[model samples]
Target: MRQSLLALLAKEPAHGYELKQALEAIFGSAYPSPNIGQIYVTLGRLEKDGHVRSVGVEQSNRPNKKVYYITAAGLETLQAWAEEPTEGPRVRDEFFMKLVLAPMTGLSDRMALINRQRRHYLSLMRELGELAERTDPGDRVALLLIEGAMLHLQADLDWLERCQEELP
Candidate 1:
């Protein structure tokens, strides 16, 4: 969460609401949605740690919002995080777990689930492609995110095809 918050601040100065929106847009329905509380907590931590600071306050009709901007130290932290070396490939695949466990179920049920997931992933990939194309050309970060999402979906599709061939 800290790394994610730092990266979001690096993109642009945003109020808590906008930051939450961006996170929801990126994560979709997979994870629990972030709330104002989560955003504020992250901001408070970042501010206390000197990675981010309150830039200004905006008075809205509803309430005043504190806007945050990333400091140079924050950017440096992000850079270091980005540069860190680690294990070759990290894999935490819920879908694969589902696939592995499907053999206990009826064949029709298993196939139906696979087909449904394939269609959903394909739809998501198409949406990601459209989003990448629609994003501002200068927004390379967003485009890269979309690209990664699309690639993952495509790989899933490939796996689904292979399963189709191997099964029945």
Candidate 2:
């Protein structure tokens, strides 16, 4: 989020509300929108870390707004972050932990858990499909994001099947 905000500021300075609106426009359907308070908190942290700076702009009828801008150091950080590879899939993730530990911990039947999770993923896939259909055909970025999420969910369902076979 820090890098994302920095990248936005690298384009142009914006007040917290503007930043929140921009992010919500981008990912609100696919992911949760950033809370206004969260945006301000992150901005505070970025300013404290010297990656960004803020200047208060006076308003005639409202409280002054602090607009944020990326510093030179922030631009360098954003550039380096852009070059960094995203982390790949993990081997021992939460579902894996449940598949292995749930029985021992008396949490629930493993098969029941798997069945429930499979249903959840399928439901999400259906929702994403609907989202894709509703999405503007020209918005390739949003379509690609939905497609990627669907693929990941498909992979997760496949992995659940493997767990059922091996653990049974």
Candidate 3:
């Protein structure tokens, strides 16, 4: 979130509301809208860290707004984040833990758990598929994001099958 804000500010100095709108425009419905308070808190932290500086802008009828600008340190941090590879998916996820520890925990229905998780993934895939279809064809970024999510869902379903096969 911090890095995302920095990148946005790098493009142009903007107030928190403007940043939120920009974020919604870019990510669309793929991500939840960030809370206004969360944005301000992140901005405060960025200011404390010297990654951003804010100035008050007065308006005739409205309270003064603080516009934030990215500093050199923020740009460097954003660049580094953009260049870094994200960590791979976790192998020992919470569901996996539940699957492995079910017997000791008196939850012996492992197949049921796997099937439930599979159903959840399938439902999400269906929703994403519908979203992709409704999205404009020219919006290549959104299409790519939807496709990537679908692929991940497919992989998850395959893993669930593997888990079922290995379970007693």
Per-residue lDDT of model 1, residues 84-107, tens digit only: 985544443776666667777645
Candidate 3: list runs displaced more than 4 Å. none
User: Which residue pairs collide in model 2, if any?
Assistant: none
- Per-candidate TM vs. native? 0.52, 0.84, 0.88
Q: Could you tell me which residue pairs clash in candidate 1?
A: none
Give per-candidate clash totals.
0, 0, 0
lDDT of 3 by residue, 1-168 (tens): 998999899999999999999999998766788999999999999999999999999999999999999999988899899999988866638888899888777856898888898889889988998899999888777788889888878888898999999989
Error of 1 at 62 (Å): 16
Model 2, position 17, has a per-residue lDDT of 92
Judged by whole-model lDDT over C-alpha atoms, candidate 3 comes out at 0.90
lDDT for each residue of candidate 2 in 79-106, tens digit (9 for 90 to 100) = 9999999889675488788888889988
**Predicted structure with the largest TM-score when compared to the true one:** 3
82 Cα displacement, candidate 1 (Å): 4.8
What C-alpha lDDT do the candidate models reach, one value each? 0.79, 0.88, 0.90
